[model samples]
Target chain A: MQIARHIAEQPTTIVESYRSAARTLETYAPGPIGRVLLIGSGSSFNAGTVALPSMRAAFAGEVSVVGPQDFLRRPDTVPVRGTLAVVVSQSGASATSLEVARRAAAMGCATLVLTANAESAAAALGLPLVLMPAGDETIGPKTKGYVASVAALQAIAARFGADIADPAELAPNLEAALAAAETRAKALAPALDKVDTILVAGDGADFGTALEGSLKIAEIAGIPTAAYTIEEALHGRLHGLSERSLVLAIAADEVGRTEASTVREALAPHGIAVETVAAGPTDALPTPWCTLASTFLFQYMAVELALRRGREPDLMRYPGLTRRLAIKVDDSQ
Target chain B: MQIARHIAEQPTTIVESYRSAARTLETYAPGPIGRVLLIGSGSSFNAGTVALPSMRAAFAGEVSVVGPQDFLRRPDTVPVRGTLAVVVSQSGASATSLEVARRAAAMGCATLVLTANAESAAAALGLPLVLMPAGDETIGPKTKGYVASVAALQAIAARFGADIADPAELAPNLEAALAAAETRAKALAPALDKVDTILVAGDGADFGTALEGSLKIAEIAGIPTAAYTIEEALHGRLHGLSERSLVLAIAADEVGRTEASTVREALAPHGIAVETVAAGPTDALPTPWCTLASTFLFQYMAVELALRRGREPDLMRYPGLTRRLAIKVDDSQ
Candidate 1:
């Protein structure tokens, strides 16, 4: 499948994306960026969540991530004074993202667009575009796009803090994790395919990885899945789980270890299946690198699960499922 | 049945909660708060979401809502200095919330607790507590507690900025909405009870209402339910929706009306059921009052659906589901 191939090629694309963003940052003068607002939809939004640590470290002021739809509509929610709004979209054709860029530009924000396609609709808006160049993939369910966007954002964050890790250095760890994930997914698919629901939970920093994983599985396999902070899951979402529930937890640090164990123990009585994907040692690499590895591992699981369901990993089975995304249809007409 | 009664009495509880908070605010000195951080798990976190608009209006800096576990573990994610952290738990027994309050107080941030039970573990923390007494609700699902927390937060935000809505004035409109919602729930339950999955979507301003609604339904009816921003739902979640799926949307304004309509049209071809619960005539009252109405309406829907399934509305069907929350047990032991 095209998306699987894209997933396999992300280690290289992510490195290239970082280098490209680094070069772009040399000349990009985003003056007095008091508050950093990252705006996107779908996977881009998920990427923003994972990139928060770097963003916070780079910026002195508050950092926030929000979907483009909200920023476009309720501009008041985000303060425009001394603010920089970074708009991210893989295709650059997402109607909501374009609207957000336009609105932010009009509001006198230091607006920037991060995209792979320079000729896409969003590029034509005349906003300063930082090209990440993730290459082209016809099939949806972004893999390389998500990685490239995060890598690019990390590069932008680096401009603010010299201590930010170089994205080029993350590829080796990601490749190793990918190889390990390939084996793990093949072995787990048969058991996972039989499950009625998927609950993916991640500790604080890795919550976005859980969200993106749940989304990939849902879109690729047509599975009923939900993601939450492990803390939120313990609150009430656990009632939805049972013997047919497959719980995938991401834990990269000590707190996550505790959370993952607690989840497993609590669900053990209900006979719910549990799996943990750890990002190895947290101190061994930059936080985002570990986060990317966890994210990549989940993407492989989604691909393998789609195959187990006798569905094409690249092509979505449900019609109109991806219809409402990236493109704006004039349904009102 | 007890939860339903607790829910019905919230209009009065909400008013009293706000008045109590207002009186407490006169003596509270949370000096020079630069940022507002509200942390909780489950319904408490959702209540923080419902209060975002007011929180934003009241603070000069940023306002963020996060689960307590995340805040406690990923201390770097949130800016601590000159921050006001409002810790919320209905029972105040949530171990995660207590840890968060303790950490915030140690960090020199002014910390406050909003809870229904003063004796429920968290009150002993010695951080000044603004009691929002929601009365006794032995049921697992929270109704009055949610209403009261929002009221208290609203009162706090009012103290910070004079422009926030007056909770005292919101009671009559809430009473009117409650009378209307009881009728809507009875008519909607038979159809909803037959659904295999429930997908609740709300526009930007009302997304928290959707979250609370989804939580109520999940705990009370034991339904497999998920909530998303209307735009996020359009992105990918629609794939899992079909004839047996029920979609509840909240649209209280022009933009939301458009979004709700687009969602209905997009899903109609797939035979997915869509229901829009709009808080009529926003000009008649403050926006948060209308939002509370929509939240109450969904709570009633959950109660009616629980009755339709022949499940006790007050008792959670799944044992040990809420056990892991609030109180942390030593899993290693």
Candidate 2:
């Protein structure tokens, strides 16, 4: 109920605040960083998938994204010199992210913390912080927090040298995208209603977006779902691709469009019903009604999918489980 | 047949040479210099998993391990300063491992290239090249390459700071372990005969060992299989645990004894047939056998399993498929 009220009151403003914060980052630290590492846990980690392509395009150097769990367990894999560590967290108190931040600082790398809470431990670690304005959620499972993180990261990418042709045009496009998403969500609600398993796919920038979309459905719908890069899905996992599987493909940009099309083609032969929301053809201004718009639509679709299955779209029962088993950090050793 | 010959002729001198090289590392570098990063691919990476616990115990600072695929994908996650990058490869031609070495050199990290070929690309990069004397394999899949990589890394650990109790004592222990592994494999062959799917479980050092064991089975036996850390196995994946699932639990030293015990206990409750290969008692002498002996046993068991299922263990129709597809690096991009 608390999450529902928060969602009802500030959905548009939360999206707007993300746009504003992204503009702030562009104004502050613009241009190529030597290396970029995105680290987070669970949904926060999954959120990084959405930003992968954009981050690679924005940062001229190598971009590597991993779960904080991987980084914590394998710190030596982290570059010690001239590297930028971007720690992503919704609560911002994820034990592993904090430890990674501490380790990165000790190794003398430039660190940036992104979270909904600017005052969280990650921010307190003296790193430059990007705070999402979507406020906070007391919900046991993340819904708003997840979307807010994606929007804030999108803003960060836009601010920090994303190859967008027109920066000033982003706001209106984003607004339109959200509206388009709502309409699409309503239309797709029926198909999502009866599905027990889902498969989401994308490539490049949308790969992470597809992953987040899959996680959103899993966390909210309690349905077994998996996400894969388009190429990886085709390798061996394609055997699981079938008519009964609800395949959601996000084709957000030119890099992913061809692969997304290939995936759709491959699945069609198997009689799998494919739902594709892609960046519209290039002649028009890259409208939010296309790629960026599809993200919100998928989030809405996941909610509808949950409702279609007769599950509450917002309620989560697994509260305190995450905090209790907060990623075990071996600080003592 | 080719793989069998490669194993039979694999020089014991290679083991001796690795021991000498490890001693050289101890004499020069002694104790942990900074952070140590172990990098490898396929079987070589599997060797790192076996070496991790002892390496961590011996080194003063952090010791983390990852495969070349993971390292190349996320170099920013690796420590860039005051770090030593250990690149392990048997052939040293492995594209990913070579790239990792190049990246480490670019980052100004001290690099140690361990390989069978002294003139390998990884070695030619002018890092401290420690050569193993293991001969070439005609078979596409690894056999002796797997064991040699482990022996080489184990020697390095002993040299750097691994508490092996007595260095001179390892050779005899390794021989005994190999013989014991052969015996165990034959005894367990009956259970593995009919299994179509295999699951391997271990904790700590053996976690990586189990992964390699499973990979060998998958690559050689051509069966669907997966390996997970014992803790990860308990996290919902246990639902898939079954009698049809051939479970190989590698119970190595005290480092993993508790979790290994838990995995063994958990499986029986689910009616999953479990086989436990005791590497040693909880307080056994620290040796590769303590981690690897069980893995070696399972590799042969898996082959027998494949034989019973009417599949030829050595003839891989999928040879180079994983290398060509599963791990295609976008080097051009």
Maximum-DockQ candidate: 1
For model 1, what TM-score does chain A reach?
Answer: 0.94
Given candidate 1, what's the lDDT at residue B64? 84
Best by lDDT: 1
DockQ of each: 0.54, 0.08
What's the TM-score of each model vs. the native? 0.92, 0.59
- Give the deviation of candidate 2 from the true structure as CA RMSD: 8.4
- Model 2 per-residue lDDT at B242: 40
Best by TM-score: 1
Q: Write the per-residue lDDT of candidate 1 for residues B110-170, one digit (tens) a residue.
A: 8998888877677778888988879887667779989898889888888888475675676
The candidate 2 chain A region of ten consecutive residues with least summed lDDT is: A324-333
iRMS (Å) per candidate: 2.1, 7.2
Residue-by-residue lDDT tens digits, candidate 2, A108-220: 77777777766677667777777776665655545566667766666666666676433244545555555666677788777655454566776545656665666566556
Given candidate 1, what's the lDDT at residue B148? Answer: 91
- Alpha-carbon error at A133 in model 2, in Å? 8.9
